[model samples]
Target: MKKTTFAFYRKTMLTMISLGLLLNCSALTFAEENSNTDENQQVQEEILVEQTEVLTEEVAVELQKEETVEQSNKSIQTPKVHFSIYFVAEANGEVTGQTKFDSLVSSDLFSNIVTAIPTPVANEGYEFSGWYWGNSYIGSTSSEVYSYFKRGAALSDLTITAKFKQVETPKVHFSIYFVAETNGELTGQTKFDSLVSSDLFSNIVTAIPTPVANEGYEFSGWYWGNSYIGSTSSEVYSYFKRGAALSDLTITAKFKQATPKFNVTVKFVTEGKGSLTGNVTFDSTTSDLFKDVVATMPTPVAEEGNTFDGWYLNGSLIGTTSQEVYTTLENTKLLESTEIVAKFVENTQAQDPITPPTDTPTTPPTAENPQPEQPVINEPVEPVVNNPGQAQQITPVAPEVQDETILDDATPEVINANNLDTIEEEVTPLALGHDSWSLINLVLTLGIAALAIMMVIGKKTTNDETRKVNKNAKVIGCITAVISIIIFILTQDMSNPMALVDKWTIVMLILGLVQVVTSFINYKVKENNEVESVNC
Candidate 1:
């Protein structure tokens, strides 16, 4: 029983195995068919896409052809323009002829355009002036005219012409004259004749000829027909007008005789110091002209222990002043010559340099033979010794009388006239009333006062320079004032106090003038400074 059952089970197992193999084969075949169908759809889609691309390319080519046709239609609508330049020829107020060749210019051409300028043809007795465009002138030659035309732009057609005219010139001539004289007499004459052109002018002579003068004569003035022209300087015609000078003219020169002069000699005879006279000039009596000549007089300088003496001319005292002297050329006295001498001597009023004698006489003076009182001489004196017996025997001597009156208290002292004359040799004469020392003292005082006043004025003003000047003025004024006061005291007695100011009147006047001038200058400067500041 067991063997039969096992056989049936085996048969069932085989049948199940066969069914499984069939199911697997069917599934694989269905999968293969689906893949082939997907491949066929993909090939159809690729073919449709290629056809759509070809149709778009054809549409673009047709649009390009239409655009090309529209461009060709616009190109035929516009046209280019061209222009030509012309030139003509003309004569004086007439149409002469035409030129063989003319300028050919075009508006189409740029800066590269070049046109030929027509050359002027030959004409009888006619000069070619220049080319002309209406009222505008070009040049005389074709080359010069073409240069002007080339520099311009060609806007339109135009024409130009060449002008001609005749030429002429003029001739001219001139002449000049000169004259000279010596000592109011004619000496010589000069004539200049020359040719000139309307356009040309020249100097007649480079210089004037010098005139000859006779002995004791001099050239005076130049004259033209009795009218004074000028000096003997050269005249010129560097600037001359055509046909202006045609006829010859005469000029005259004048002269005069030289003047006479005199010699003035100076001599210093005194101990002081002095200047007398020197070289001087005077005009001649022959000439009407007067020359102002200043002759310098000697400066009187005082020596130690001495004073200045007045000047003497021909042994006679003339004056004591040492100022500048003036004389005319016609003075006959000066022609004979002049000589002046200055004298100086010791000052007796000054303190004595030597000691005096102290002894007194024992005998009383009688009225008939009065003796001079013993003098207190400053100079050295010899001593006398009286022997008792010799004094009784000696004879009485008479006293000498002096020209001047004796003082009431002292007995009159007698001196020789000749000796007194020697002492008075240097004394100043009061002929002029003013004493030199007194005058000088008074002047100095006045000057000092005036200077001080000026200083004050300057100080009151504005400006640094003015102030400095004022300081100097003040110092000088003070010094002068002190000196003047000392001089005034020494010159006069104390009894005449008012005389000090009165004597210095001239000096004061001069000083006042100086102060006024200085003040004026200071005021002007201050005003100028203020004006400058305002301008700034």
Candidate 2:
């Protein structure tokens, strides 16, 4: 009985070793068969690992060769085994349903089987950390292959909870404000305040607001603290950034006012009989300070005997012009309340005529019986006076007209019987021995001599007209010589012959010499021309 028991134990040990080998060989065969499929290959690799561990240290001692062969044949003949893989979601990620895995397995197959791995889903504001198997972390892979070999043969269900790290996106807010200068308003005024993401943290793309129309105001630019942000424009936008950890940002849009103007008044006045022309009503602003305004002065329409003088400003003479006066309105004095005047004066050349008294009778009175009614006339008169002793009623006679030019320098003289006849002979001489006879004789001599000289100079050859003119010149020359000599002789007084000879006598003598010289020259030229004509 002892020998039989020892032999039985040895056989049992041998069978267990053979079965363990068969199980290992069967696991390898399954791994080779499904190696082409990714899921199947993964499952087979897991099962091979578990089976190797068991076969290495525990499988031979547990089962005999016959039993191991029976389990291997049973696993190969049986259909696929069903198992559940549960995926739990976290951090707003997508939840996964239970996944089913089917595979042929043996008693050792459960130790080597691989579990189904679910695909990881994404979530905003959260980063995927890693996958979890119950309370333990599996891997960071999205679709990692899981093995349940360590769970043993009774393991059929798996619970994997998805893990995630909470994303910390700090919130930021920016405030925008519209600011204006004193008494200035803005148009399209607006403000902004909202939450922004760390990735989406940027400036606001908005144009700066403008001032209202006709407000005389202008928009400058947006400002952040003391620095300039941007200019004002309809198409422009502003940018806001967080520079500090706890930022308190506020921007301002600035505006400015317009410039002021001044008032100016000008007046135009006439000092003479003239008037102001061209926009006399001068009231304007200093906006056109660079330009000069002109005011034309009207021509002075003086009275009958008056003349225009010149233009004056504040009693001082500016300039003189007979046509029109022009004054510059740009003068600083004219910018304020001021006036300009035109002056005139009487013409000295325009004088009134002097007339004799009309009340005096033209008739002269006798010394013995002068009419009491006749006024005694101290001034000179032209009618004749009768010296009859009896008082005779005489008809009033018209006074003789006298030459004003001649009387301008001559004094009146009374004529008596003794000098009456001599005065009449001197005044109305029929011959050329009168008071103006010298001037007439000189004028005639000069005129005739000039004509003769012109004819001689102009003549190419001697003609009948030429000869006639020369003969007339000779006759006038001889008459002028004789008259001059006679006048010279008459001007000298025998009683006072040494007295200063009158200047007129010397002039007459000089004229006589000139006439004689001119006549001789004319005669010589005429003779030469006549000879030339004859020779031709």
Candidate 3:
């Protein structure tokens, strides 16, 4: 039983091992197939990705080409236009030829031409052919055209008939350039247009007309108001009339007037076109001719006293009672008037005194000589004077005289005169008053008061220490007191106030007051210091 069990176990083990190998092989094959399939799938996916990348690259290149084509189309679409026109004489008429123009179609020629063409009319048996030869089409849209036609035999003269149609009142500006040919023929060629001449037009037109004007019209001259017109063969004519009537012309009169007490001469000259007429009237109130003469003429005055008393005209002295006659040249009847005044000076000396005449005896003494011998009997006899004393006693007797005659003749009179000595003594005191004394007193009083106040205020402050206070106070007090004494001496009037007694009295009083105040303060401070020491 044991051996049989062993064989079955071995077979079972071998069968199990064989089954494991088969399973391993089947898994290996399945894994290999799956890996190969995955590798193929990866390769296929890589190819699809590369194809997508190539397609994307092709799409980008196409987009770039499309942009290039669009840009090229834009470049070709808006081309710059450049053109020029030239006038050429054809067989029968003048035609404008297009020398060069930008790329344009045939239909664009009509609008690009500068000139207009008129429709032909059939007259008689002649027919009008429209256009001869020329390609005038221009622009990209081909909406413009230009045509040229030759004149037929029916037309005798070639006339350029141009009718301007202002579709929008187009401001047509043109510029002409003249090209001189070698044969001395001048031709106008268009160079540019829309030229602005406002900056230099006035200066240019002020001189001569441009050469582009008609050759027949002559530009003559220009003035303030109007321009002159002239022809090639006739004289120039002015626009201003020669003699024109002026209305409401105002004439202003100006003349020189004399100033106060002075004469003036005026000379007139006209500036405007006119003649002045009128007499110049002058009044004595407004004119200074007579006033100036009177101011210059000297008046007469008394020689003895300061008084003006008379006047003289031309060396003729006028009396005080004479009428007020003015000096004038009116009666002289001269062409130019002149006045000559003579100044009169009166003699003011006192008049001479009159003398009285004394009476004398008119009768002659010779006829009365006979009566002299017959002396009067009543005449007293001559006294005999041989024996002196005794003869005098025997003299003839004389008649008695009246006492009343002596009394009425004369009386005694007494006269007294004042002495000059007392008068001079009295006038001396009145000449000098008390003006000096009042002035001196006022000055001295004010000066003394100011000095005393300065001394009190200039004292040292109370807050200073003892040594510093004493030193400063002494120095300041001495200086102030010395200055005050000096001021007192300078301002005092020594002559009037009893000399030293009155002048020094106020100064001594001020010094005494200062000393008293200083001494009292020093004593009080000393007592306070002593008390503080005892209490400590």
Who wins the TM-score comparison?
2
Sorted on lDDT, best first, the list reads 2, 1, 3
Q: Which runs of model 3 end up more than 4 angstroms from their true locations?
A: 1-283, 287-464, 498-520, 533-536
lDDT of each: 0.51, 0.53, 0.36
TM-score of each: 0.20, 0.29, 0.18
Cα distance off (Å), candidate 2, residue 392? 66
Give the clashing residue pairs of candidate 2, or none.
15-65, 47-112, 203-240
Instruction: Please provide, for model 3 over 53-166, each residue's C-alpha lDDT reduced to its tens digit, 9 standing for 90 to 100.
Output: 665565566556656766777777754433323323323332343322232333234234334433323334333233322443121111222313221211121223211121
Candidate 2 C-alpha lDDT tens digits along 282-301:
55565423123333434446
Candidate 3 or 2, higher TM-score: 2
Best by lDDT: 2
Q: Order of all candidates by TM-score, from best down to worst?
A: 2, 1, 3
The predictions' CA RMSDs to the true structure, in order, are 35.4, 33.7, 35.7
Q: Flag regions of model 2 displaced more than 4 Å.
A: 1-83, 90-131, 135-156, 163-170, 173-214, 224-246, 258-275, 279-536
Q: Residues 231-317, candidate 1: write the lDDT tens digits.
A: 646332322323355555565666787654433333334433533344423333333221222235446666677676776656766
TM-score of 3: 0.18
Candidate 2, TM-score vs. the true structure?
Answer: 0.29
